[model samples]
Target: MQNRRLFLGSVAATAAVAGLSACTSMGGFSLTEAVRRLLQLSANRAFDRLLQPEGFWDDQVTRLALPDMVGNGRGDVLARILTGPMFKDRLAHAFNRTAARAARNAAPAVAEAVRGIGIRNALALLHGRPDEATTYLRGEMAGRLIDVMLPEFGDALHTASDPLIGEVMAALTGVNTAALANDLAVKADDAIWRAIGQEEAAIRADPRSTNDPVLIGALSVR
Candidate 1:
């Protein structure tokens, strides 16, 4: 799952180039188009990675593990248990297995929704503020994602067969969902600035990239 996020980030970065090109040609780009392109790029990369043998299982980053209860300041309950014998490995393995399965199940819907984002909101997003664009996409699709993914994750958890493992998975799911949401918020802000900063820097550096719609739109914001 971590790997999935990483892969998504990378793809978004890559997509920025294509988006810039598209925006340049279009005279003005839509934030929706930018995000849709990001999603499309990310999904393609994720699908490629997942098709690999070690895709979800062998990748250390994607391979799930117990939440770091210590650094995260959760409490001693998890620490005490982790320090104890027997259950630690079991707990870790169970969570990873569940997360891997959930990623597999959730991939399709995510891809579909991302594509939908391309078609539905790309134009509107391009015209909106950075945070507004992010909020729009999240509001439009988060509930749909939760509805689709939660059930799949729940099913995967149910099949785990270990009661303790299930408990850990439940905890992990809650943690991951919150983390993902927070991360997206940060990414949205970062992406906004990145888009603006990069464009400004390019204009200063090359002078030819000036007058582009993306740059114009961003500059118009404030």
Candidate 2:
């Protein structure tokens, strides 16, 4: 219990420091630059939290379902087989769990998106509305997500199979892999952005959230 408390306390301390750091301009800090760093921090933190097993399972907004096929014949048949209401609930749950398992492996992709942020773009995002940064990140990271997360998702999917899922995929062929990968990437990215936006809102609303004098000083100037 004491160890758990210490861990929580350390996490809180880190968040406070990050919040303060986001606001400050000392050591050649530009507000725009600080905001970019903050966005990256927020995005990474979001993925860290939301990619956990519970994060994907418990969050309604991010819950996964079997892909919906509009018209492709084989795909449609496959989708129906996988998504029949009775079968779908279990499959969806398993699908989300697979995504959760693959979450840790996605850090590099997230980091790359952060690194791609330019100074001009940072300035624009810093001054934009609450969800703008997240939107920008979604666009920037969307394509890369499939590349980064596909292998991890595939690995997780191998472990997540049930008898029904296994039988269907074997008979139908596992073309759903591409669809699942794309869906997981999109949903996971959205969940990450939501987490970042929430953190950003909290920090913007509260001045005493962190103790970093440098960050606080920088925030005061802007």
Q: Which candidate leads the pack in TM-score? A: 2
lDDT string, candidate 2, 182-202, tens digits: 766666655555677776655
lDDT of 1 by residue, 1-222 (tens): 999999998897656645554665345665555455444443444445543434544554344444454124243454554565566766655554544444454457656765666345444444444334435544556545444444444454555476765555444433564444233333222322233333323333432344445444433331
Colliding pairs, model 1: 30-126, 31-125, 31-126, 32-122, 32-125, 32-126, 33-122
Q: Identify the candidate with maximal lDDT.
A: 2
**Global Cα RMSD, each model:** 14.2, 11.3
RMSD of 1: 14.2
In candidate 2, which residue pairs get closer than 3 Å at backbone N, Cα or C atoms, i.e. clash? 24-215
Task: Give each model's clash number.
Answer: 7, 1
- Residue 211 CA displacement from its true place in model 2, Å: 4.2
